[model samples]
Target: MAIEDNPSREALEFEGQTTVIHDYAAKLVPGILQTEAYAREVLGSGARPKSDEERDRLLSTRLARAGILGDFHSPVMWSLLDEAVLRRPIGGPAVMCHQLRHIAALGEQRRVRLHVLPFEVGAHSLLDGIVSLMWFEDLPPIAYVEGLRTGRAPFCS
Candidate 1:
């Protein structure tokens, strides 16, 4: 079960209490941490700017506190983060370094997998916008494709 949030595609307004986005992230993080291969394939193995060693240490500590290590032990979970995401300095040099190091550590886990879709990969089906797919135990796969005006749901056969 992978719950991915694309800031560009999703308009997440901060309301009091737990927003749907945060709820989704919180729910999925545990599963993602358990699957080491999936974590590496998405968060790690991406290009980023330079940073210092202190930032790396901070990232490790944060990851551990966040219970990422426990998540790596799960057998059925993963998530994907674009290369552009890893490169983007959401915070600053230190923050970015910590984040990237966290990603790299998660990547090193055998059960986790991270994939970097290079900028050169160019446009694809998701170029127009963002979409998410959810797989349920007793139900068919559901996909949510959102646009500026509205969204649509398509079932996966």
Candidate 2:
């Protein structure tokens, strides 16, 4: 018998099939752009933390998703982040610095077009949650909305 049930795997497949990835993160950084250390810190902490083994599996999948960014036909990633996400500093200053540097490096390489939505911008449409929009050349776009602990991928026809 075969049992196939994994939301993360489905999410990864959705991400992998896209030709362009445009995301707006209101609080935390997008998972695809997260560094290994930052991802580990996030996966290990939280209200209902996972076991080390579980965290490892999740980390591996997250990293694999990041790997797609380096592929020959990688999607063009555009990310807009809230200023709060930068100031909040996850995993301490050192880890935050590393994460920031990693993002900067990606921008420099033109792998991602990064934008910072300053706090002064005040409230906006996407202020309530993270929105990820993936575009495909031949198929309809997929918009994924994620909150603190939940997410929904809605397809518009």
Candidate 3:
């Protein structure tokens, strides 16, 4: 997911409507897979720094996007992670530990498929950002591409 002053509205609406999600991340953990503490830390780490209320509100919105993953019936999430995401501790050791365990548990439960690209693999495309592809039952698929300062999730059919 793209963490910004305001999260991408298109991406949010699209995710809620999609049937399958293919996510690839090179830096940070994708939103749907983030734990509460991890998400809080990320949302609060903005350069402008939000007030407690603002952070809480944003956190709630971010987490709410994951609700679709709760149902066992559909919207399968396939996550491809670059090794750096696992190596970097975003919210200190405790929070990081919980985050890792959460991802692992999700994999064990077959909720989300986790694919980690090791550091040894070295230099590759999409190393500087995150991209997510979504498929819908009644709509055409689209891709969300997030860069250092830009996040575009326009729908295409």
Clashes of each: 20, 0, 0
Please identify model 2 stretches exceeding 4 Å from their true place: 1-6
Give the poorly placed runs of model 1, Cα more than 4 Å off: 1-69, 72-75, 128-130, 144-157
Looking at candidate 3, what is the lDDT of residue 124? 96
- Cα lDDT of model 3 overall? 0.82
Which residue window of length 10 is worst by lDDT in model 3?
Answer: 1-10
lDDT string, candidate 2, 68-151, tens digits: 888758899999999998888899999999999999999998899999999999988888867889998888998877554455
lDDT of 1 by residue, 1-157 (tens): 1113222112111111111111112112222232233322223323543244533432343234334234433322244544566566544566556656765776676433555556687765544543545454455555445443233444355
Candidate 2 least-lDDT 10 residues: 1-10
Best by TM-score: 2
Give stretches of model 3 more than 4 Å off. Answer: 1-5, 147-150, 155-157
Q: TM-score of the candidate numbered 3?
A: 0.89
Top-lDDT candidate index: 3
Per-model RMSD to reference = 12.1, 2.4, 2.9
